[model samples]
Target: MASAVKDSRSGYGTLLRTPGAWTFLLPGFLARQPFAMLTIGIVLLVQSTTGSYGTAGAVSATTGVAMALFAPQGGKLADRFGQRAVLLPGVLVHAAGVAALITLALAHAPLWALLAVAVPTGASTPQVGPMVRARWAARLGAGPLMPTAAAFESVTDEFTFVVGPVLATALCTGIHPAAGLVAEAALTLAGGLLFAAQKRSQPAVHRPGSGERPRVSALSVPGVRVLIVAFLGIGAVFGGMQVSLTAFTQHIGQPGINGVLYGIFAGGNMLAGIACGAITWKVGPRRRLLVAYGLLALATTPLWAVTAVPLLGAVGLVVGLCIAPALITGYTLVETLVPATARTEAFTWLTGAVALGQAAAATSAGQLADGFGPSTGFLVPLAGTALACTVLLALRAHLLPRRSAGGAEAAAGHLPAQVSAGAEDRERELARA
Candidate 1:
């Protein structure tokens, strides 16, 4: 029975067998809903009310920067205290900020008022991505199945991205501009609180409580910086694509349907991530990363000519295919790079880098879209992909770990739930040492 489950296509069956999986995974998915909705919501709301794309972009950028600057500290706090300690308060603050933003936007508040409220709002993001992944890592150690789990999670994330924007737009266009953010505020409170409450699956907080030798920090590692920078470049691609797509939709006089097009963009990622989970990967992380980067560069360049909605959606689908697999590989690499103790913080740092890149791209791309045109803004994503490809090629070796990550995991006594005979020998040796 176990073997049959393990051999099942996609490995989701095996992944979900962990105790209390659904209890937490459901809320985690809901918490991630805002990841896609909030930005687009802000963009649409501020643009419509204030009649300034540049201001809209600037506000989004402020939120991104605030989130970027505080994410690591949030993770640090979670590591030191506990997930509940950090997350419970974080969610409420975030909900309040979103509510305030919506009310102020509807009232047509001053730009400075909106921007000031947005800073704290963005900073209040509850560290959803890292915390959820950390829970999975704790439940299923870093091993073969870990890849499948990451892939599945990536697929879920893609689905959230697909639905979030569509849902946000529906509420905004169907109901009111402020309605989308109202929903966001509700989800942040409900989903975040529920997710944090699932304490059973939460990873054990790792902190120096006493005179125990301090665990090695992820930042001190050599290759980690490179990986973070790589994530930054990738985030730039996403940020530019998002901002440009918004401009493109508005330019085409179909701003309401942009959500469907964006959803299609994520639909491809959802499909690819599902397939990626079903198959066992033979390629190492470094090689897979380069190939993914190559695909991103190739796929995004044609987006330059995407004047029509269908062409843009098709091209968006193509580019979307590369995102999930690349993110999966990056997650796997970051997990392997850090010690088990620092996994949450390490993961959040990757998000921080991505947020930072998104901030820069959104700010600049919005200006480009507003002044030069949406066509010019599209160049940012293509340029970002090209630069990321270049960086990955130049620093491939430097970004790779010096030692075997699997072996290190074994040495740390963090083997998977099921170990093959070949792995058993290594596990035994590590045990003896």
Candidate 2:
């Protein structure tokens, strides 16, 4: 049924016609304002207070690790108790942690206080990404609307990264070192609360006290394991690329514009993501996903040979075009595979998988760059993408099953009734089409 979702009307304008789509997307945008700023803001905040970049890096990493480890738990809470219930408390805890961190920095408190608070800050992250994606899946069901929403979120991600770090850097240096962190806390509270208020769109939660463990965890589902692992590889590609791109720019003596070039790369993906959503895709989601991964694997290899800056930028654009499509398709596949009851957790695991891959690849690429050169570091993303392609290839039958009764069962999953209604609606819509 997911594979059957197609659109002859080829434009983003159609998506806005869904009633209250803007209501959901706008606050979702607001909810993300603090996330991009947090890591850099933490780094700057700690460094300013402690005069130790190492400590700053450590604290930031601690926050990230805590966030990663707890994300699934947060998702589980959202599944058991509605999104609003989970998000409201997350809003408070996250804001308080950030506020405490800022106050400690200003007060010149000990490093341990800063480190301790970072855990709650990360743990209490509102999980806006997963929540919003789940909401889209619930509202639109397994149709082109699914991919469009995914692409829109992907585009939003690009926009945040492009502007977020710049804004954080400016606030930290221009105002006070604590300014970005303060702003981050304020935005977190405002955005989180606003988003929670939109309770009408929230996905139905699994009831409490019916309390046998779920028949299948998100990871236990067929094809989900491969999805998580493939995402890990994709994440590594990103992490490795970040390090390699930095190295390449410095090699060319244009270290100053590394961010500019990265932005161009992201811009290419942003446009491609939108195009991928707007078109009527005849190819199955699995094929499109595999093709995108294969393209990324091939596109990144030339980075090892190219020495010119402009050529590198051009190649980066090519590589960038493949990423969002892969991500958009991946989310679509996950929607088809995961039962709606476990949806948020399934998506959170996907995010965690990527985070893990990025961390490992970033470390490896940094080492290779230090040992050999920056261009050599390019091998990391190339290798990562190849692995992703390999994983997708291995899971092809499971991930992209044929259109038969078995396929319908796989796509229908064991979703709860409230969630399954959306799937049935999509099927009826497809029949009309």
Clashes of each: 0, 0
* Consecutive 10-residue window with the lowest summed lDDT within model 1: 1-10
**Which digits, one per residue and each the tens of the lDDT, describe model 1 over residues 233-341?**
7777767877888788888888877788878888888898888888765545556677887888788888867787888889989988988778777887765566667
- Give the winner by TM-score: 1
Question: Which regions of candidate 1 are displaced past 4 Å?
Answer: 1-10, 209-211, 404-433
Residues 64-116, candidate 2: write the lDDT tens digits. Answer: 66776788888888887888888899889998999888888889888788889
For all predicted structures, in order, the TM-scores are 0.90, 0.79
Clashing pairs in 1: none
